[model samples]
Target: MTRKLHTLSTVTALFAGLATAHGLPATAEAAPTGQTVAAQDVSPSMLSAMQRDLGLSEEQIHRRLAFEATAARVELRLSQELGSTFGGAWLNEDGSQLIVGVTDEASAALVRLAGAEPRRVARSKAQLDRVMDELDRNAANASASSIHTWYVDLPTNSVVVTAADSVMSKFQAENFIARTSGAKDGTIRVVRSAEAPRPLYDTRGGDAYYPGNARCSIGFAVNGGFVTAGHCGGVGTTTSGHNRVAQGTVRGSSFPGNDYGWVQTNGSWASQPWVNNYAGGNDVVSGSSEAGIGASICRSGSTTGKRCGAIQAKNVTVNYSNGPVYGLTQTNVCAEGGDSGGSWLSGNQAQGVTSGGSGNCTSGGTTFFQPLNPILSVYGLSLTTNGGGGGGKGFVSRLNGKCIDVPNSNFSDGVQLQMWDCNGTNAQKFTWVGSTLQIGGKCVDVANASTANGTPIQLVSCNGNRAQDFVLSGAGDLVSYLANKCVDIKDVSSASGAKLHLWDCNGAANQKWDYR
Candidate 1:
């Protein structure tokens, strides 16, 4: 997979645009585009696309264009002198300096000769040297029963060496510290071999049965349900509340490659927009927008409950012990096994679900999560509360008392309803007042908005818009704008096309729909 370099200027512009659209303060500093030059020197289309997508002001665009030109010149000189063996080059996080990585001392010297600053130390190389020196020094003291393992903790910028009880073990630790005295802070803790537990979820706790227990926070609530991380549970899995009271059932789930799911519940469990009740206070769920690396984020889970960290990288692919999952964002937050499906948020906005990570809060580690936007779009689910619950009105029923004509038009249990533009027709004339959209007197709804498109629209006790929005046509079956299809049950029967198709309405029983 190709890794795209994230441009700081683009990120700034995106934030500015979002701020402007949402009436928030524009907190981003404007970036320099590049040096002025001939039109032939730049890719006009690429420049235009950046400006549009990134929402760059003209001055910012021009400045960045100039910066790019100068950087290109610098790149050419460095490449020619250092040859193809040079490692890589990237702009610093501030976009003010260029960092070029060279393979060895020779390449580093060449780069410096080319008028570029070259730092002598490579952390990885320095680490390897320290390790080898320690091993060689301790070889004479090595005993038959010794085990050693080395690992890097990027968050703390430290290297850890785990070893079994032996003379070599003590020697290795002392020698490593002595050789790399200048490399890191001189703080090392020797943990006993048996005390170092492997990092994986131990699903042995009774509290693990709740959604919060699994670390998955609520995204959005639909008519009769809410959506969350699929890895938390599978279809038909029973769920309980933090207090261990029966809450809901996993209506649908998908994991490994895709991480998303939805749950349907009775009225006893009311959905809220609140996330973690940190010792300070309960964190709110605001809205969802993709945040850039270096942006601050907070998470709420059952185990490590609530914590804040910065986003380290986006679109990272992680191979967990369970399986390979793609498009996860890495962070410095600490999470344990039960926290797998927990909520990851930027400020009050929804970000993603905690997938997995190495390390713990005590020692520090890297955690990864699946982004929420794609999951919402794919499954056609909305995040319930922006910051997690309190700010907005609770769930409303999409169908209540309106009008009904066709007998089976009231969807049977276990199907989803879509919204279509209302046309004054009896099928579309439902009054959505409170939590439920009422037609005549009954409530119309979907069993659940599972990704399966053919899920039917049904009538039930009013919940809210989670199942309400509907599109109407003067001469055909009512369509759902949410699902982008017409109201149709699983084909009168559950066969292949028996799954409803949103054909041009011919005013049939399958097409007519009434909220009540």
Candidate 2:
């Protein structure tokens, strides 16, 4: 059978990404001693979400959850036993073998004895940490954009600095790291990147918090209030909720060194552990359990709602045009302006706050976030959910995380539906209500309730009519209950203007729906 080709970098294809983290450190702190996941305890919703986003079977999801748990324990043991030599650890692409990073033959031997595979590298975690810290210090007084970011690349076992190919002073990045304690004689590589990251900020409106004139998303609700990106505002800055009503005040804020902030809300608003799913539901947060490298992750933002992806790397230092922000976790999830301070959740556990990233949801991109544990520890704040948060959005591609957009925001009655780009706009939003895929409380109806192939789907006032009912098939097809016909992308085109209509289910990509 011919397989559908997809951009593996997308939220829908996060698990399919080929380049796993070969070099990196913990994105969040290690699981508390003796803490490990047991697949039996994994939530059904979380498992279902993994199935939807990663294209894994229920059995695969269950098995991988156990593997992730074991991987976490093995990583912790290697981290403790190997000490500075422990570069990183991740499950191989198939999620079967655990690959550990070691800087010496001795450490590799130790890892092999622990029942894992070990890859050798040049710089130890200690050496890489020192290099990043030095770069951070040097970057403090420098300009932004010259170098987008720098981080320990455990794959190559060095510190990788990112900048556009057009950057004339790319050498400055390498030279800066060279000044680190052992970088001159150690490993530090410079690579060209596509876009420079900036703190997601906007002056417009949406589901966001306001600090004076600046607008940003709420990361996650905590005990006293919520957490967000420090770049949104500074300490003592007053804020307003999405309602524009008096919201809260920034009790503490930090940037450059670390991009994080917390807002203590007023009595008008209280915390809720539930995060609103843009697709149409609320996810219950369970705990702040740390996921291992290469694990699946999702985010929630006021601008994008929710999106999914996998954890790419950790201990990263990002260089925004403003300056360098240290200790960030990276992912391939796309994020846009105004998405900062959003929620990044991994299997119901709050991950981090959206920091900065390059790219839009349309074309795809990379993003970073301030991990939740550090933020929680720093402020002594409690996540509203049973789990914890760093708070960000994938701005993912799930039905709940993404939108089944109308082409170009045009909402004509007969306009053909398209899976364009997802943004927190009314035109792009979709809600599954009762048995219907709804928009603005209108049902996604079949043209005349016809069973004929190629009949268009449109919006109409919802009734109990069976013609408005649909089912998402196991193969990801949105099949109408009216005719057992599948909602398909007309002509199988993935372009922005592709029209959608009912067709026979054939397990095609255009017919597949990922509603996380």
Question: 289-394, model 1: which lDDT tens digit per residue?
Answer: 4554444456666666565566665544343334445566777777776666566655444677666676777777667777876665555444455312222221
How would you encode candidate 2's per-residue C-alpha lDDT over 312-346 as one tens digit per residue? 77888887766678889998787887677777767
Q: After aligning candidate 2 to the native by TM-score, how far in Å is the CA of 109 from where it should be?
A: 3.6
TM-score of each predicted structure versus truth: 0.41, 0.63
Supply the global lDDT for candidate 1.
Answer: 0.46
Cα displacement (Å) at residue 354, model 1: 0.9
RMSD of 1: 17.6
Cα RMSD, each candidate: 17.6, 20.2
Candidate 2's displacement at residue 376, Å, is 1.1
